[model samples]
Target: MARRIKVLQLHPDYNIKAHDFADLGEQIFRALPPARFETVNAFLRGRPTGDQPESRAERSIYFEFSDAQLKGMRIRAMWQLFRYCRSQRFDVVICNRFKPVNMMLMLNRWLKIPLCIGIAHGFGEYDRAYRRQQTARLVSPAWRFVGVSPAVRQYLLDCRCGFTERNTVAITNAIDIVQAEGLQLSRDEARSQLGLEPHVRLVGALGRLVPVKGHIHLIRAFAQIAGAHPDAQLAIIGAGREHDRLLREVELLGLQGRVHLLGFRENALRYVRAFDIWAMPSLAEGLGLALLEGMSGRLPVIASDVPAMLPLIQGAGGIAVAPADVEGLSRALDEYLSLSDEQLQMKGEQSYRYLTERHDIEVFRQQYLELIDSALSEVTL
Candidate 1:
């Protein structure tokens, strides 16, 4: 077998154990044979916190360092990598995301022969501009870049960030559905496991509880639905600073009993199938991976009318409402709540059909493989 390229994936922290959208670099790199990508986590004041992973991937490592610590052992980690690159043995170096791109770029002066590539998963045009300008200064010596969405790719291209359109490809967000076998559990079974009543209409949202997720809007919309359907309950998975604020809003709206906050379920997709309606009202996203997972679980979604969600909702699978419009969101939920079980199943099936055809794991894997293969050829030149 041929030797595989070596990659280094960087991230700040593993939020809710998602390994972050930034960690998509390592996920794709792991799929390539004999190729090893180690995860390097940069914590603010100390080591990153979380339970250690039980997965088969032993190559992953998280480093917590202060400015003082960055000078000691962390310096050695970079020096060691530099020396390894100088051996002229590895095929390439993939520097994942851009938090410390400048440091990586500055230190690659030690690289003897291997090429450097970047994986950028920016969400919006403004953010892309802000990040790329910062990245150019630190300049990790990456010869190519990959993004997860066309919107992201366009953002880079518009800025003329020194990457040719051909060199900046779209690989998209992906997950291994097979790993979560019980993730596709039947609605009744999942509801039973969670002790959910059979009669309650559940409108569910999943993702980190960040402001960008627009959970506040979902809560506002659900408050209206709760007004109409007292038997309806809004359930959200994922935890963050926004939790208490969201709960406070629920109470202020007098929806403490009607709205249930289920924080960060490990099997998010499994719990999704139990939902009467899956809602994604994100203000922005590179692409909604959680929404993809929700669709795969046969859940009909009512999402925001952003570039990323338009394709998913335009098909028969779900509804798309104006962003940040509570009334529109409430109206969509009200209509969904009135749907018969058979009608809901049909919409869910439609979502499944569209997602399987356009956004399945195999499609994502091949796209990633092709990106790497093409980048290797360019780097060889």
Candidate 2:
């Protein structure tokens, strides 16, 4: 019989933000072979009152701070992580972000199990200058560090860690594309369900409405598009602080009727199909899953020519415009609208083709399993 691999996933539930860990955790669970693994989770509830997370399902491990104090919470979290590690005998620990993981790494060095993996959800190159890894107190004891994008791994490689390209791998985020793609409903069908008219052209974006996401730039671009197409509308499907503020901008732009803010939807995946065009004008992104989700549903995408999309789109599929360039985005949208069904289909097909080759669900699942399997190979851990 094969040895069983015990895995513990850590998540900090704060405010209303459904961080990327939610998707990453669920996908990994779905990918792993149930018979070969046992799974658990540790959620940090440090902040007493901000906004509660949506819904949750319990697992083998649970730790909650249930109070508010930054320093105290960090200390309690570090303690709880060690206790969790010692208690569960986890063969592998997958840490979502840096903070708690780094803390755990330093604490675990004494009786290290040797299979610690840092699955980075945030891309570092977008922000601060690279930090000193050796001096950084919380570097994971993890054999491999998984970056959601090649850009992230390259950023680390440029940082000059001791291992010469031996420790990092770019595992692009994956969705259950088998269940998602090709089941696309007709635009008319989707519009009818969305209470939209046949003649109205809908441009949509999906993600948390935040400044970093650059949804505001997209709104600006859409305002320019709406200036001409009286019936054109923009629908944003996620909720955040920027929600009310963005709506205010729409009203100020005299687009109260044109821009629709559909706060977080239960079936947001379904909404991606309804869009005539999908826009991702983010200033920074680890990897644009929404872009792949939109493309899988056959929508022509117009993304910012940033690292995430530039590497994937390669100037094809739909349009790649300069970041914050509202005129460029508007022009791309116009060009897409001018294309005939066949021409549009050709662009949409490029998206589908790229996804099939690069972001297939199986590719992601296999890579994840292989990494965990290798990490847990030697130890009785």
Clashes of each: 3, 2
Each prediction's whole-model lDDT (CA): 0.66, 0.70
lDDT of candidate 1 at residue 240, scale 0 to 100: 92
After TM-score superposition, the amount by which residue 362's alpha carbon in candidate 2 deviates from its true location, in angstroms, is 0.7
TM-score of 2: 0.85
List residue ranges in candidate 1 displaced over 4 A: 1-4, 7-26, 35-51, 54-58, 61-63, 67-89, 124-142, 379-381
Query: Candidate 1 — which pairs collide?
Result: 102-138, 105-140, 238-264
Candidate 2 — worst ten consecutive residues by lDDT sum?
A: 13-22
Cα displacement (angstroms), candidate 2, residue 364, comes to 0.4
Task: TM-score each candidate.
Answer: 0.82, 0.85
Which candidate's TM-score is highest?
2
Per-residue C-alpha lDDT of model 2 across residues 1-381, encoded as one tens digit per residue = 877677777666532234332277667766677788777666666333445354232363445565452253466666767776887787777777765455556666753756877766656622343434541444544557778888767766666652236667889886667677544567788777667666777788899888887888878877787766776788888989998789888888888778888888765776666777788888877788888888787777888888767877673456888888888888987787677668777777788778778787777878899888776665545
Residue 206 in model 1: lDDT: 88
TM-score of 1: 0.82
Over the full model, what C-alpha lDDT does candidate 1 score relative to the true structure?
0.66
Residue 300, candidate 2: how far off, in angstroms?
Answer: 1.1
Q: Give lDDT for model 2.
A: 0.70
